[model samples]
Target: MPDGYSTLHPAMHGMVNIGVRAARRAGEIMVRHLNRLESLEVIEKGRNEFVSAVDRLAEEAVIEVIRDHYPEHAILGEESGASGDHEYQWIIDPLDGTTNYLHGFPVYAVSIAVAQAGTLKHGVVYDPLRQEIFTASRGQGAQLDGRRIRVSKQISLRGALLATGFPYRITASRTDTYLDMLRAVLIETAGVRRLGSAALDLCYVAAGRVDGFWELGLQKWDIAAGTLIIREAGGRISDFNGTDAFIESGDLVAGTPKVYAALSKLLAPYARGL
Candidate 1:
């Protein structure tokens, strides 16, 4: 365990510790299989969405840990569907950025979050390539490798560097809508980046690496951990309509309060009727 783990909020110490362990275990599986892509079995979940053997193995690793310590806790994982109906649910994205991983891009991650009675309580996002762990508990501030972190203080959109992602299923209507939002932000901000991992993008926002981020069509496991981390790091996240239902809507815009507000305003016209 890292020294920062010692500084976690006392009340959430157990859950955070368990989440970190599970994430690291899954991350290890990803790292071990990262270079051996030729043997991996890949499946196309949808038009452009993919899953691989590593995803299943990593997800199993995560679930094994959770089940070992908390058998009654439910699980909602990307590779595996939901299981065990319980008040305590663990949302797991065993391997985020699978496409990047398969291409040896070194941008993938393991994300895990625990919700108690429908409210997010603890979250962890581990980038095994960099060995960086971003974590947060409901009331405790967010941290990176044990050091506290916060969103960028940039107050204006013109000077902010933003991140976003294009949906996998790019229908004609979806493409036009996404492009409109992209163009609006591209013209106003320092630049826009598509990192292919929403979990890491939100962690970047929490760590001040990027000023803000927005994307549509993300899953619960993708944004669950990252959103909680962002909030704990003095950031705001919301759906296109500036509401707190982003997890349900899967359209999120997150950043420092000022940047979030400005970014949302910029995309408002394009998001009308969404």
Candidate 2:
């Protein structure tokens, strides 16, 4: 067990342990595959969306570990899709930045989250390149490699540094709206970053590396773990409509309390008819 594992709620011990182990295993597979990207097979799942052999192998590594310890638990994986329909569902994205990884851009992660009866219980986001793990269990707070972490104290958008992902996969009709929204946010904040990995982007938000993060068209596996970490770290999250429907809608806005409020207000107009 790692140093910080003991600090989480006892009820979450088993899940968190398995989550970390699975994530690490996936991370190892990702690193090993990085050196051989050219020889790996690739597939296009959608316009501007892709998957590589490494993604499947890494997800398999994660799922194998999870099934070993909790064979009956449900799982929702990026590569394999959902299996089982139990109360405890493990949502995982074994390689979050496949495009970046394919291009050797090096910003990706292994994300895993467990939800019991539809409520998030624990999460783990592991960055293989940096060898850092961000973790949280409901009501136990968030941590990075065992030390506690908190959202940034930046209360206003005026100087806040925010992160976001472009909705490349579903941008055909929403391009103008998204660009306008981006323009609004960019003009108000210090700047914005379109990092290749949404999981790492949210983890960065939880660690206060960025004051906030928002994105559209994300899958459950993309934000499940990071959302729990942000909440446990004392940050706030909501759909563009400022509701708790991000999980289903995949349109999310999150930040420290004050920043969340400010950003939500600014983005509300853009979300009016959506």
| TM-score for each candidate, following the candidate numbering | 0.95, 0.95
Regions of candidate 2 where Cα sits further than 4 Å from its true position: 1-12
- Model 1, residue 2: displacement in angstroms? 5.1
Instruction: Give stretches of model 1 more than 4 Å off.
Output: 1-12
Write model 1 residue lDDT over 169-230, tens digit each, in one string.
Answer: 65677778888899899999999988988999999999999999999878899999999999
What RMSD, rounded to one decimal, does every model reach? Answer: 1.9, 2.3
Clashes of 1: 0
- Pairs in steric clash, model 2: none
lDDT agreement of model 2 with the native? 0.89
Q: Give the Å error, residue 28, model 2.
A: 0.5
Question: In each prediction, how many residue pairs overlap at the backbone (N, C-alpha, C within less than 3 A)?
Answer: 0, 0
Tens digit of lDDT per residue, candidate 2, span 77-133? Answer: 988999997999999999999999999997999999999999999999999888888
Minimum summed lDDT over a 10-residue window in model 2 is located at 1-10
